[model samples]
Target: MRLESVVPLIPAELVAALDHSCGIRTDTDLLFFGSSLDIIKKLPLGTVTLSDLEKFTELVAEQASVPGHRGDEILAGSRRISEKHSQASCGVKELDDLVGGFGDSRVFEISGAKGSGKTALALQIVIQGLLADADSCALWIDTSGDFSAEKTAQLVRHFDLAVSDKLLERLQVSLGFNIEAVHDVLDALRNSLSSSRTVGPAVQWIVIDSITPLLLPSLSAVSSQGHAMMTTFMRRLRELAQTFGITIMVINGTSAAAPFNQSSAFASTNRKPALGPSFTFMTDCTLWLSKTKDMPDSEGPFSVHVAEVFRSRATRSRIWCTFQIRHGVLSSTIPDL
Candidate 1:
């Protein structure tokens, strides 16, 4: 409270003297910070009686505020938990444990050389997620137009027709040859999901298999527009994911040389992830997949594969797990200690 606010309680003769000469304008100023004796000394010795100062002090003391909590104390009281409330497995237990599993409202990137099984890994996770939660569905965006239905069916061939058919039915696949194509697909998909009367299971996951083609053409040494477009594209994807609680996974194939974004293409052998370092922080986590040595005591088709956590906010970077693809299924393998 200001000195004027307590005017009725304060003596009329003392108002101007205490307010101006004392410099105690606010209720806080009138508190003990400025000693009562100091205030009395500042006032006219004859005009203000000690009894009058005591009365004024009592009135202002009623309006003084208590101290508040410090920033560190408040932060300590509200410490955060990093674990996600809901997690969708990657179908391999060891692999799932390696990177904290896929969770809602986060973007994940899988980058690797061609034939390293990036697409296969993404598809398996989606299928497993759908099976794990019956109410969940997924959107598969095939950017290169070569997404194989036959291969996808092969993985679910062992299951009964009813289960397999329904899972595949719930999965909606679309071709997106360019950035515009994928953006349109995502926009329409988001709109359809917003309706309360949606036709089927709610979409809970999205896989953009190989984002190279969609973004490669827009990049060059002199142009920054491509990067801007990429940022916007990712922003929209994140918005959709957060709004609907969808988990987004993007496949980023590698390039042979550091500056060979144009030379590199999806489904081809390359040395590094295409596009450039811009992808380092675009996603919540980055998993690098690559084919390793063949499994011993088995047929040649099943080779040991490695999935490394190149970057993550929830898991330690550079940590990796090994698995094998046997009979169209992913199985976790423990390496000798």
Candidate 2:
């Protein structure tokens, strides 16, 4: 059957041309709706009639085959996405190679025991991100009040000195000790994104220095409200990440004991992220940072930390990368001993 022959068989009154202006072009878009009510809502009220609804099913059955974009378009798009992911960096070359860089619009958690260098890793990532591009901005949410001006300066000094101050200016810090305060910070950020008069560049990353503080107090045995509150907070975090296309890094802690009736958050390890299972569910990637005692994990004077991909949608198997801090600079590969 000729493509043109099938087209004239359908009445023009029954179905108008599926154009971009109408927000539908193919069967896929039309099939996305559950019923005619949704399609009716898309049009001006009363333009579509009961008669149209009557023939809607028949309209679908005899629908003309509309040509979508070329099939090669999907492969091209996938390649572009692959290239973008390749371009994204975690500020550490070795770590980026291991689990792939922190790509767009996702939540990544850095979890470890107390002395395992979680904050250092996150700080390095944000500072590097800031230094890489002048237009790039970031937000540091200080839950435990660990964010320090002097410390951040010390970290960025390892990169470029000429533009360090200018880049540092792009980073904003807010002390959000409680859940409500964090929500308020996000609300303010959402508003800033909406307002045209906003002077500052839109942020690329949001780093939460130790999510444990903001959440631990609420996970109580006496009340389910705590968990409910936690759920709401996590959902909001997810929404902000998706809506604003920001990469979120949350610092978390590990607990010796697992939650009741559930395996460890990362099945390969016994120690679990302290915020409970729901936190893990919300996270797109879990980059587990830990201080290793093994000889292979270290070289000389620097304290070598092992970074493992506990959970990542992009990776299939467990992958680990080693990093160390030398002269206040964090590097995935230790410099010549």
Candidate 3:
């Protein structure tokens, strides 16, 4: 049946004629009260009721579809713009040099032993993106509950951001203790990005404080079901990153055994890939942060070796760069090498 026949079936309250006096396209499908075209097209001809229309409108409004844009094409265009932006920006020189700036639909895994400044780097990205005036927002998925409001405030104060209040409001931190909670938060975040214009740009970065927590439990479980669950979760994360043009940075904790060398620091050891090669393979870039004991005592000062991009697969794999966190700002010593 034609939409015209269905028009009479629609309640008088829900059906309103378009004001074509303004010269807008009236020949198209009828616009619902909620302004969703999807509902108009999907509404059945004879049996559809006002309540059905309302429900359809609500469903579409809640989970709107992403505009169809080619991911590779978008990334290519964004790369040129990001390179220019990175050249002007400070602190991110080493990182920008390596990857030419983080690309949309990319998953970067930062893995190393604990206290490797993974969280610090993630925070830096949030601030730098804001500084670049990209109208971007970050989603901090804190699995470890280690994200500090105080730290964020310090960074805000250090930068003296003119839009401190606005930027702070834009950066959303969701604390999820369990895997289920994490999944739920991720879903809610995606839905918010799809539905709310007020949330600014679709979440530019999704930083999961640690992906290992979810992985380790799944890997250790007694049944094959556990492995399936793990695979499903990782696939979902990849899908989310690709669908929304968002960059996902997941911090992973490395085992005591060295990732590359099998030789144990102690006597007896069972060596394996620090974190499974599966994670390394899944990620677009695998960065390692480690202290450089080789630096002279006078040059390095304390043993705190700052942040280092140890392993980046994009441009060069075995490049090492040093960085310092001063006044809550990450300053890299290495130039674009």
Candidate 4:
């Protein structure tokens, strides 16, 4: 089936030649409708005709221009479209209630300074998914060289999640040293998910532990180009979420607090994330982790970490919760709540 032969098979009247300069507008609507009507009349009726009618109506709605009529037609005849994905518990009841858990088909951001338990949270998300289903799996892209198998196993054991060979086989881990490596890993993951018909049911979560390291190399050298690249990468992550019906968690490191200078007020506000506006704009939810000061003495083995949901589209109220990490497992600090 050569393209040339296929082209000749199409009705010459339907095909527009390069030299044809006629505009498709109100003046030519009748001619266009006549051509389309003739083509449809040739097709088999019943199912094909009914199925195409809806698509044709949508096409007409897009190009319609009957002063206020387009809105009415679309509203009355068309259905609202939205991405579909399942929601899973984030291992903490308060956080789950705050943001409706980690929503599939959405990008969630966890930003914080060093030793803020960002990686610990990400690993627990994987464990949670596995706990939900024995066969459930997750992908971890370690851009910061901090992913630990020992920690993962400890979390699985402490949480009593699936720890069999089959469960381990389902989980996929890839090390990404640089931005190019990260892109390559994402591409490979996308292809694998696309090829497998049952990927959505098998793979439940994907985490990029610390996206800041991948951008640090170019942040000072080519600021504009670096931002553009970061935007592209974030967009791709969003697409992967929507297309695969999976939750995406990206860990981002924040900038160091500026030296206290009484002369400048803006110096104190420099505690934002490293990548800036583009990264935050793409995420559906952004949570920041900060170490709490002067906590009451407790006999617990692990210290408590606080999470603040500063930006989120899923919930209206501002939320803050305290959780603890012990032996790689995470749990709410307040047991009564």
Which candidate tops lDDT?
Answer: 1
By summed lDDT, the worst window of 10 consecutive residues in model 4 runs over 18-27
Candidate 4: regions farther than 4 A off = 1-87, 161-164, 196-201, 220-223, 257-270, 293-300, 335-337
lDDT tens readout by residue for model 4, 138-166:
88888757677876766666666445444
Clashing pairs in 4: none
Per-residue CA lDDT of model 3 for 167-285, tens digit only, reads 78768899887776787787677668677564445577788888878667756435554454555566667767766667788888877554343322322333222445555666777
Runs in model 2 deviating more than 4 A are 1-86, 258-270, 293-300, 334-337
**Which lDDT value does model 4 have at 123?**
76
How many clashes in each structure?
0, 0, 0, 0
TM-score of 2: 0.68
**All predictions: root-mean-square deviation over Cα?**
19.2, 12.5, 12.3, 12.9
- Model 3 compared with the native: what TM-score? 0.64
List the candidates ranked by lDDT, beginning with the highest: 1, 2, 4, 3
Residue 279 miss distance in model 4 (angstroms)? 1.8
Give the better candidate number (3 or 4) by TM-score: 4
- Worst lDDT 10-window in candidate 3: 19-28
Q: What is the TM-score of each candidate against the true structure?
A: 0.69, 0.68, 0.64, 0.67
2 versus 3: better lDDT goes to: 2
Candidate 1 C-alpha lDDT tens digits along 1-337 = 3455466788666767776787655454566335677777887768677777887788766544333568996454323212322557876888888778777457888898877778878888888888777888889999878888887887866443458877888788999887767866876787698877777588888999888888888778896656755665776676677667788999997767533333222233246677787776888888888787765554536767778787887788877777887666787764661
